[model samples]
Target: MNRLSDKEAIDLLKHGDILELGQQANKIRQEKHPGNTVTFIVDRNINYTNVCLNECRFCAFFRRENRKDAYLLPIETILQKVKETQEAGGTQVMLQGGLHPSLPFEYYLNMINTIKTAFPDIVIHSFSPAEILHFSKIANKSIKETLQDLRSAGLASLPGGGAEILVDRVRKIVSPKKIMTDDWLKVMETAHSIGMESTATMVLGLGETIEERIEHMRRVRDLQDKTGGFRAFIMWTFQPGNTQLGGNKLSSWEYLKTLAVSRLYFDNISHIQGSWVTQGQQIGQITLAFGADDLGSIMLEENVVRAAGTAYQMSIDKMVNTIEKADFKAAQRDTEYNIIRRF
Candidate 1:
């Protein structure tokens, strides 16, 4: 099949029949993954601190430094979480937090080093582009230098957070103080250039138009074509509860339609993960038929979505059941998308 053009993607997203789009997407997914297997990772998202400077409007997780509830977890606490993750059979630790102002650059390096030192087997797929940019400024170094420093300190990969829309118009409205489109892309590109692999993500219902969503995917696809460093493309709906950008959630139909379009658009990307965290299990199950080959993260611990007032719990048994009931074999994967176990 010809690679989807920008106009073609936009047209499919805007006007194509949802079922047809899903069928096309599922065909592509099956072509890439002929095994009829769906994967999930046993990981934890340990938000070390809620204190932030770039209080993005769409987030309910961040707090000002002086806020009574704001916190920066001690290195001991972070290590404890990593210990728990290891005990719980988790292979990855996603150590994401807000942009704390007073924390020195060495704080992050120490955090990564300490975690890896304590848990040598755990994959530290932590940090975001926004955090990287913040670290660069804090360390007075270039993006490459900052990433190199982190990588040397045992940072395994990055999570595609803080890339809500990846268009400046929407970004300026939702997160005026956060890193903009070019900066986010540059951070990812630089990370890729240094051999650090990562995932790409999109949160729908951020008030971005169809064209802008396609544009976001275009940038990611173009970069993947160059570096081939992105292991997966994960898409989810924006949870609006308790957020400053409070609004109704986008319909699951719309979410699935866009997801199918993403599967079609990102021909160069490998995995398309369904977000059971944001959309619940039923829709997450439906995502398999719509082109998703993986249900991301049996996230052992997640607070960001809970802070936004959306919470869904999943365990190994539940995750396996969710996938098996959908008629696909369920397996646990590591940070690199390597199958570690089968159910």
Candidate 2:
């Protein structure tokens, strides 16, 4: 496939037939991953705390510091969750949380070290770019130094959250207080510089235009060209049910179309993930034909999306069956997209 210019991508996204777009994306997927296999990981999303300093308009998961329900998970409680994840056949834990004003940098280090010490083998895919920037501010460290410290403390990779859209125009409206576009890229670049790989994500339907969506992909593709550190690109429609950014959910067609366009545009990134967590099981299955080679996670626990009132549950057996019913083999993978088990 020829590399698409930004204008060409926007044109295709705005005027292309949904089925044809999906076909083009599926061709790319087949070329990249020849085998007819969809991969998933067994993981749990552990929110260490809900107390947030940045009260973004699009978030339903964050609480003010003084909220009655705001609480941080104790180290022992985190350990127990890790133990449960291990027993449930999980290979990774996506530990993310909102920015807390009072938690010192040492608290994060201790959390990472404690989890790694208890479960040496489980992949610790924790923290978003926003969280990293917060740590840097409080610790008085550069982004590179903060990433290095986290790596030394056993943070394997990043989850690519808090990146609603890379365009500052949309970002200012949705999550004004969070780190902006360049800061997010800097965190990923710094991580990649130190040999850590992470994924890139786009949360569409944030009242962004088609051009803006293409712009988001262009930024990610440009950074991938520089570092080649991003393993995959995942796009999900914004869930606005219970959030301050309330609007009707985007249609399944829009989700699939944007996802398909993302696959075609992000030619540099290797994998595309389908979000069953937001779109439900059937659309997740349809995504296999539309360019997703990975079905995201058989999440043992997910809270943020649940808080937004769009939760879909998937067990190991159900995940495999869904993939198979879509006429593809299902496989389990680790944080780095390495296949672990095939079914």
> Tens-digit lDDT track for model 2 on 1-343?
5898898888887899999999999999999999898999999999989999989998899999889999999899999999999999999998989999999999999999999998999899989999999999999999999989999999999878888899999999999899999999999999999999999899988999988888888899999999999998988888997899898888999999989888888889999999999999999999999999999999899999899998898999999999999999999998988899998
For model 1 the local lDDT of residue 151 reads: 92
TM-score of each: 0.99, 0.99
Residue lDDT tens for model 1, 1-343 = 9999999999998899999999999999999999999999998999999999999889999999999999999888889989999999999999989999999999999999998999999999989999999999999999999999999999999999888988999999989999999999999999999899999988889899999999999989999999998999988888999999999899999999999999998999999999889999899999999999999998989999999999999999999999999899998988888899999
User: How many backbone collisions does model 2 have?
Assistant: 0
Q: Positional deviation of 302 in candidate 2, in angstroms?
A: 0.4
Q: What overall lDDT goes with each candidate model?
A: 0.93, 0.92
Leading candidate by lDDT:
1
Clash counts for all predictions: 0, 0
| Candidate 2 residue spans exceeding 4 A from truth | none
